[model samples]
Target: MNKQPSHASEFLWSTPDAFEETKIAAPGTNLELETGAAAGLYGAAEVGNNVQSVWDIASSPEMGAGEDIVVGQKFSIYRCDALLGQGGMGKVYLAYHTELARPCALKITSPGKLTRGDDLKVRTAEEARSAAALIHPNIVTVHALGEARGRQYIEMELVAGGSLKHLLRREGPLPTLQALRWMSAIASGMDYAHRQGILHRDIKPENILICGRGVPKLADFGLAHRIGRGEYIPRGFVCGTLPYLAPEVIQTGDHSTATDVYALGVSLYYLLTGRLPFYADSLEDFTQQILTAPCPEVRELRPEIPLNVAGLVSRLMAREASNRPSSGTEAWHLLNSVLGQLRDVQSILDEALGYDPTVSWIRCGEKYCVRVQRPDGRQQRVFIESSEHRSDEQLLLIYSVCCPAESSFYETALRMNAEFSHGGLAIREVDGAPHFVMVDTYPRGTVDSEELRKSVHEIAEHADQVEKWLTGEDRN
Candidate 1:
């Protein structure tokens, strides 16, 4: 009897997400089951994300040596040409469209990035092909994937904001609203893939790109695969960033939409607090923590975290398979519910009955900016910025209240004390008038787009609160 070949003989398996093609399952591996009755062939892919399937695995696969790329080469796109950058996935040349006069990003993978031997080459091709099939606003569109001069390359949209890693490292965690805004766009992109029956196994900060316009584009579908089909990932390998992997991914190699949600939740936790839910004091502790430890409570780090927001992400971090949100859609809803009621810090302070800080008071502009130690002996500040734009939600998590630094990103939703800066904090009047002014501009992120937006919003919101408090007292 002739054995049927698994649909494993194709490169560029198209389903969803931008980078789903990198993970390929070995189709002809052996499996010993049930007391060694009969060895079976297993095609369990270690790269869990639905990837491109390619047939015809030759003994020797094609590869591009890095030295092969020409300094200025062009690729064809929709009625145009574009240049590629000389970086990862081969030299990415910058290209421009002549007819449309549009610029595009083109990349060619060098053979060096694919050193895992014969089967891995086939898998890489599948990844390129799969990524080629994905097209979304939040996804860098793969214009095409093909080989030139024994080198395989892909053409994609050139987003301006650069990588999320660059942004986060530069500025730190985003304002709650900004992070949510980016997450929503990312979810929409993931939703596009799920609609097409694909799961992004490698959902980490690095793979998510931020466009210059602050739009989030989910890229790097190099490890994606179909729902099943031996899962098309590398066998016995969890191919993704260590911090974002779901519990199931490490245990049984089972992946689905829930896996993506788990990763997103982890990303959000890192985003809001600028800290991981589980930090290992050591390597052993790190692995063990992933296996059995629960994520830290958001409130424990920053008291300002909205209760609904914390609980929402907490549900996604559930260890049990059945407990987490079924899909990114559900996660999106939960996120919105938590973020819907945006309020200024003064209101929150008023509701909390206000706080009195004992420290040095320095005048920032006209308002007083007070610096004080938190209840946990950590230093933090409570100041306000007035903004009609963010009258709803006006606070930021500069850092953990448990570990506040002399300067942090966690600007309070409260008003800044403008009387003095003697080290501790207190709200005092200036010229017999209540006015909270924020005058600190610490560069948090590597670059400052998100940070700038956050600061401007905080400053405006702080000013608004001072005006409100003054008006309310006048009426009384």
Candidate 2:
């Protein structure tokens, strides 16, 4: 008798709000089970998110220092120009489409048992292709799915800014408003995925990418489930990050929309506290804790977090899955309500900057300009706008002066940029003339009066310095 390979070799894999009244499943009555396991098997490796699979592959002898795929390698219609990074499931490359002349992120994986045969491979590819059918701004667009020399590949929109996991690691605990905005965005995307009959069995920070403009895009649908597909996994097997898994999933191997909600709650806790809800040294200990222990309160770790936001997290992480929000749609609305109850954007900005309303500041769309008079009787113009390409979603302040577009000015601008760390000077063409500008950016929502004042002063001071340089003044 021949033994069949298990699909074990495969794949990998936010939000807040509100005191809004909504229906939730009654504790005992909400134990419905959905088939299929993801994030793969309930072993000790399940502690993290989809990355656990990467760890497993890395430790395996098969993942030895494989031959490096150099730049300009061809894969069907796409050419691999650079290796972006590697994950548990496969290696990601920066590839270019020869036909379309566009760049894309190409994820290559063996998918183990999922690719055991021609029929299974074709079916799995079709299932993954279904992900491409999903169209939403908050979700990463899956362009195409194909196979090259038996290796499965997915072509997707390349997000340049990196992942939410990277952001949390770099900046401890996000500002309440920014975190709420991301949470709402993720919830909206998740709701859309659920409505399309897809369950994101694995929902964690690592799967949420922050785009160039600071908008969140949910990625990694390798563990996604198509509803009513009659997929099944043995009872002991499980998928999903253990820390974020709901009690029903652990006890019965059920991966449903509620489980995703539970993961969202765990992610919210992480977003506001920069820590997991539960921590343990062993799998058994972690399992017991997740199955019976209550999630720690977010306010205890970060008291500045709004009460409604914290409360929503606790409810979403409720041990009984039914007690959590029934679906992402409900969670989305709840988040909106919580956001509405918070401070208005204009008030927050004004309060943080200690602006004098009598100064007659000018507002145009998202850009705000203010005129300042220097102590030396010089007038300076300060223009602030939300960055068009923001990796951190901050507001930028610029001070500029018209200058001749000459080699000397370009050299000075480059030198200035290299010398400064806070902000840089640049020359821009306006109406065929050049303007030398000084610009600085600060995180929005959380920047206060002292910081804003300092930034304004620095911009004005730098603009003057640039003007002096252009005039050949010896002022250093």
Give per-model TM-scores: 0.55, 0.63
lDDT of 1 by residue, 37-67 (tens): 0000011121122222221121114333445
What is the model-wide C-alpha lDDT for candidate 2?
0.62
Q: Best lDDT goes to which candidate?
A: 2
In order, candidate lDDTs are 0.50, 0.62
lDDT of 2 at 57: 34
Q: Evaluate model 1: give its TM-score.
A: 0.55
RMSD of each: 15.9, 13.9
Off by over 4 Å in 2: 1-68, 110-115, 348-476
> Which candidate number would show the highest TM-score if scored against the true structure?
2
